[model samples]
Target: MSSEIADAKPTDLPKVSSGSAVVIHPRWVRITHWINVIAMFVMITSGWRIYNASPLFAFTFPPAITIGDALDGLPGALLWHFAAMWLLAVNGATYVALGILTGRFRRKLLPIRPMDVIRDLSAALTGKLSHDDLSVYNAVQRLLYAGVIAAGVVAVASGVSIWKPVQFQEVAAVFGGYDAARFVHFFAMATIVGFLLIHITLAILVPKSLRAMILGR
Candidate 1:
């Protein structure tokens, strides 16, 4: 038996461990992710303040979740909003550019067919979605991340439209007009917020993932 084992090919050997550590997120991915998080939070809070200045309807976002009720009021909110907008745009642009140049999207986010989505959704709903590993994003994660990225792009575009309607009149018209553009912007924010809540919940459920992002291993 020992002699036969010695003649066996490497592929015939029983699989061993992949070692104790794996570097999941690179420095750029981790940095961009956190930067986006901070920018997103700042934008949302300040956005609520700006929204209170000209509420969409009888309804208004709760002050508890907004910065409007804090020091500075609407003017301060606008200041924060504008400042974070620049950060979001620049950071997001860098993230996307690097993702492309590094082929990160192609390597990790693609090959996910419609069937993959259904399979992942099924696994997730049935509580079979594995949280034991963080080497690669699951299908649900890939889809959701892609969706959030799209929403982010929409947010930027709609923001630019509302900020300079005359300059981005074409964009406003594409969204059906200024009123429609604002609606679009609001919906984009809602989508982003929804994604964020889900992301946080999952991260809480899977602490390893959070640690991997922070430590890149």
Candidate 2:
């Protein structure tokens, strides 16, 4: 038996573990992700306060979810909003740049076919979709990530247009006018918030994915 084992080819030998760890999320990706999370929370709350200053909608976000001071009011909210805006903009830009440079976007987010989306949506709604593989995204997941990235860009552009209408008049004109730009910003924020709700729900449902993000394994 010993001689027979010695004569066996490498392929004929029993499989043994290599003992290398698998990484689902890289260090930079995890870092940027958590940073963006912090920035988003601040931006959303402060933005709600800013919107209350001159609401376009009939309803307003409750003060419970906003960041504002009774002493400083709008100016205080503006301060927080601007600070979070810079954090998000810089961090988001870094994420995009790294994604493209490393081909992460192409590998993970591209080739989102309509039929695949339809099939996945049906499976997801019926609670039959498999998320066993944390590394591979379903078609619906791909579409949502791509859409939210685009929405973030729109939010930033529309925000700049509203923040400095005189300087970014061309940008404002692209959205129609100052009033139109506000509408655009509001809708962009709504889209982001909606995406966040879905994202959080999925994270809770698939705790392993959250673990992968936190531990990168």
Candidate 3:
């Protein structure tokens, strides 16, 4: 596992003299980040509750991770689920708006071609992936960020459809139907959880990288 970890060697891009560490993430980035984190936790916990109530799969999620079970049943979980939905939506909108206005998404995540993705994946597999700058993102990071945003959108859309099949008939139909919407909602949740796990694993493997998000050094 240690051998598979990548170092932050300098890339071939043009370079100028560099000094000590400086802040890369702005206040908005940090604020929305923590809010999203809290919101995701709440949503996931409560979503598990709702899922358990009428599971689409054979097995059920553990009661320990679900809010509804903690509070007795689906009602408690619904309270938390609805509450976090607003936070996630508002914070997500704020992040998107800021990313557009500040050009952060453009500079960091845009123009990631297939070749670039392949190269980054190869490097990561061979333990050659770089992270020279604490502020900037690697190709994999860019792709993952982009993918997670889409997953969030899917989660929200499917969630809304499931919440109101009549009102969001089009959305439910687009995803397939009532049952399909539930499947998509579960799938999106899985994707989000998978990304979070990968993000945490990578942070553990790369200590310097984690500090940037935490302390903003």
Candidate 4:
């Protein structure tokens, strides 16, 4: 029996484990998500600088200094913003394609159940949620993720309205005119920033969440 085992080809040997498991991200998802993240940061920074040129929201207390104003002038900010927009568009398109190809867009993200949304919201409110308990996003998460995607589309649309008001006059009109579109763009950005804060807080609360994203567990 020992001689036969020794003589066996490598392919005939039973696979053995070292007791450690490997968790890796799906290559396409990781690449796209990270690219989106970088693009978002760039957009936010440049957008803020552009906003600084004509501070939209004024408070009694002066607004805090931001990277946008500190880094460069309006032209520089516009360049960064437009470049980041293209990157975000490409990244988003790739993510959508991958989701469709893998059916993950429908299976994991879409078709959200009402009960799951309530349960997840309740869990979040009560601070009972953990990354382990929520390996995949729950219904509320799916909704929020969907909202973010929609917001991205809206942002791009509104941005174009402002970018070329003459050429995109029709698009600008859809949002009740250019000013409305500008407001929508700013509001959408604020929403995304708010989501980012909550997301990071939750990641801190459930430490494994970041690891899962990074390692694709």
Candidate with maximal TM-score: 2
Q: Per-residue alpha-carbon lDDT of model 1 for 91-183, expressed as tens digits?
A: 999999988776677556765678888998999999988877676678888898888989999999998989988988998888888888888
Q: What value does the lDDT take at residue 180 in candidate 4?
A: 85
As a TM-score, model 1 comes out at 0.86
Task: Point to the candidate with the largest lDDT.
Answer: 2
> Which lDDT tens digits does candidate 2 get at residues 1-217?
5864565455433333355655667777899999999999998899999898889979988878899777636888999999889999999999999877766676678779999999999999999999987767899999999999999999999999999899999999999989999999999999999999999999998999899889776
lDDT of 3 by residue, 1-217 (tens): 3421232123312233355557666667788988999999999988988888888889888888777654457888899999889999999999989887766776668767888888999999999988777667778888999999899999999998999999889989989988888999999999999999998899899897667677665
Q: What TM-score do all the candidates reach, one by one?
A: 0.86, 0.89, 0.85, 0.79
lDDT of each: 0.83, 0.87, 0.83, 0.74
Sliding window of 10 residues with minimal summed lDDT for model 4: 59-68
Instruction: Give the C-alpha miss distance for residue 81 in model 2, angstroms.
Output: 0.5
Residue 109 error, candidate 2, Å: 0.5
In the range 1-217, model 4's lDDT, one tens digit per residue, is 5864565455333333354433333557777988898999898887887887776688221224333334446777788898888898888888877777665565457668889889989997898755564335677789888778778888888888988888989999998898888889998888888888877787797777677577665
RMSD of 4: 9.1
Q: Is candidate 1 or candidate 4 better by TM-score?
A: 1
Residue 8's lDDT in candidate 3: 18
**Cand. 3 Cα-lDDT:** 0.83
